[model samples]
Target: MSVMELLASRRTYRRFEQKAVPQDVVEDIIEALRLSSCGANRQAVRLVVVNRPEDVARVQPLVKWAAYLPPEQGTPKADELPTLYVAVMQDTSIPGDLATDTGIALANMTLAAWAKGVGSCIMGAINKPALTRLLGIEEPQKLAFMVAFGYPAHKAGIVPLTEQTGVKYYLDEHRDYCVPKRSREEIARYL
Candidate 1:
């Protein structure tokens, strides 16, 4: 699919089927991330791929998913959790904030994952300190965010920004996950 089509179809999927993402595919995704542009070409951003069952189980609780979801629909249940996770990190030795580089790497990985029929959710609301400690990530390498990946078990679609469809995502009565995005006209204008 084309880049615009990929972007248009991409959505943050919380529920995933019980399937495994191949090691080589994850490696390719990381390779894509590594090839992405970095600030000053410093390459401060790094990734930790966690797909093992034991490690995935340990890392699951440390993440906070879908902040906009109501209490009744909070966290994903065991069966609904992701099958893989990519921990985005920044190396402190690089000597600058790597937020932009992190974003670039994440975007590359996300698109790559989507192209492979894998769904993803980029989450920033993670318990970094606990995650780092659990994953044995030391000072120089600090966790920035995480991206969860798996074959989606539920559907998510976008709608134009409107009062009926506010900025936040929600599940309709039929349980369809709907994301509301601002229209181009609302986000841009002639110079």
Candidate 2:
């Protein structure tokens, strides 16, 4: 698929099938993160892969799901949880903008996973202290975020925002996601 197509289809996936992403795909996702561009190439970002089922279960509760919808509508059930989690970290000892680097790494990793038919949710609303302890993250390494991954159980698609629709994403009658997006005319302009 074309890059634009990939970007359009790569929506945030919350509910996932109860299956592990292939080991090879996981490796590619990590490699994508490794190769992502960072501010001034400081490369302060790090990762902790949690592919083991037991570890994934332990990490699940520490991270929050979609905030736009109610818990029952947004949060994935036990059987719908992602089979893998990758903890994105920042090496505070290194000097650089952690937020920029983290965003680049997340984009690369999530796109790679999506290309291989694996879905991902980039989670930032989390219990940071507990996750740091659980993942054994030491000084100089701070938890930036966690991304959940697996084959998607539900479909999500972008919809152009209308007067009736707001910016917030919502679930359709089928529980699938409808992510409303602003039109280019509204959000961009020629100088």
Cα RMSD of predicted structure 1 = 1.3
Q: How high is the lDDT of residue 142 in model 2? A: 93
What lDDT tens digits, residue by residue, belong to model 2 across residues 71-141? Answer: 99999998899999999999999998899989999999999999999999999999999999999999989
Cα lDDT of model 1 by residue, 1-191, tens digit: 99999998888888899899887779878898879998788888888889998899999989988788875585778888899998888998996558888888888898888888899989899998899888788888889998999998888899888987789998877676899999999999999
User: Local error of candidate 2 at 33, Å?
Assistant: 1.1
TM-score of 1: 0.95
Question: What lDDT is reached at residue 49 by model 2?
Answer: 95
The reply for model 1, stretches above 4 Å from the true place, is none
lDDT measured at residue 171 in model 2 versus the true structure, 0 to 100: 94
Summed backbone clashes in each candidate are 0, 0
Candidate 1 lDDT at 13 equals: 88
Index of the highest-TM-score prediction = 2
Instruction: Evaluate all candidate structures by whole-model CA lDDT and list the values in order.
Output: 0.87, 0.93
